[model samples]
Target: MRKTTFLIPILVIAAVIGLSSMFIVDERERALVLQFGRVVAVKEEPGLAFKIPLIQEVVRYDDRILSIDVQPLEVTPLDDRRLVVDAFSRYRITDVEQFRQAVGVGGIRTAEDRLDSILRAETREVLGSVSSKDILSSDRAALMLRIRNAAIAQARALGVEVIDVRLKATDLPTQNLEATFDRMRAEREREATDERARGNEAAQRVRAQADRTVVELVSDAKREAEIIRGEADAERNMIFAEAYGADPEFFEFYRSLTAYGRAIQGGNSSMVLSPDSDFFNYLKSPNGAGQ
Candidate 1:
């Protein structure tokens, strides 16, 4: 019984040692076999890898593309326009051995910090030459390409390959945008006020012209009416003169008859004229021939 218990403990320890000596390198991972804190071998191929138990350790790194989103930064363009920029980079560890040597035990965290600094530097250097209009336009693609290329060159020291660097957002500063909107509104209001003033001036001119036309029309009508009345009165007077000249005696008789009718127009009228007066001659003679 004592021998069997001792053998069981021995087998368990051996099993643990065998498992510790072997490590896995997955398809997505790269491993560095370290002996006493010194890197000895790089296992990049997928499958089982070996390291001396208790003396060697395995450090694994991701082989897939890594992404980092940097903080929003403020940049001044060549035109002096200020913009807030948000950016990111896509990269991967191309040489695990170099990455291990450069980054040491810090791993991905250290790599990302270095990459962020490089990306920001490259972005500023490239974008500083461009105007905000270009940054916001289709030319932004070319600008991003330039940044990616520059960042790649600098980040190569870290054994990382930059696939792309892109600007996620480029926008006017909040205070700047608010000020611009206020200026635009003020300009529009000024234009509107100018237009209204011009319209009112035109309307005043038109109204004055209409009032003058009305006055001229009224004066012309009154002048024409007075001319026609004078002509009619002159014609009537000429006809009366001609009738009087044609027969002087009959005209005098008619005048006397008109006077007699005026004197006796009232029913209770009393006249003291003699019966042989010329006023009664019309009533006395059948023909209006006075005595």
Candidate 2:
């Protein structure tokens, strides 16, 4: 019984010792073997790992991609307009030994700080050198691409790979935004007023031209009417003169009858007429001239 008790205690101690020396490394975690707090080997693969109990240690580091959100920065463009810019970067560890030596097992804070500085400097460089219009429109994408490339180059020495650099938001300061909106509104109103003035001027011109054309058409029509009336009067006068010249006696008799008709038809006013007057000579007979 005494020997069995001794063996059981020894087995328990051995089991505890074995447990301290053995460890599991998940597929998602990378293990770093450290001796006396100094990195000796880096195990990036998953599975079981061994270490000297109480003499060597293991530190685990994340191998997955990490995100870093940078703070908003103020930038001034070539136009001297101040804008707030929020940015972020994505990175992953590529070299574990170099990463531990540089960043010291801290996940992404070190990389974040480094990238933030680079981003601020580059952002200032890019924005200060570019026009506001270019930053807002034409060169936004290109600027982002250049920033990414520059960040990648800078981050390489830190054993980190910069996957992307992005601008989260860009906005003018509140006071500046209000002022710009007012200016734009004023410009639009001015344009609208000018357009109205031009439209009114054009309408006036068209109306004046139409009136002039109407006057000309009316004048032409009046001239044509006068010509027609003159032609008719001339034709009637010529007919009468020709008949008078062709036969003097018959023409005289016809004219005398026409004068008598006009004298009686000159309204219903009172008039005295003498009996046996020369005006009756035409009514006497067709051949009663001397009568």
Highest lDDT: give the candidate number. 1
Using all chains and alpha carbons, the TM-scores for the candidates as numbered come to: 0.72, 0.71
Residue clash pairs of candidate 1: none
Which portions of model 1 miss their true places by more than 4 Å? 1-9, 174-178, 205-291
Q: What is the C-alpha RMSD of each candidate to the true structure, in Å?
A: 6.5, 5.4
C-alpha RMSD in Å of predicted model 1 compared with the true structure:
6.5
Residue 211 of model 2, lDDT score: 100
Best by TM-score: 1
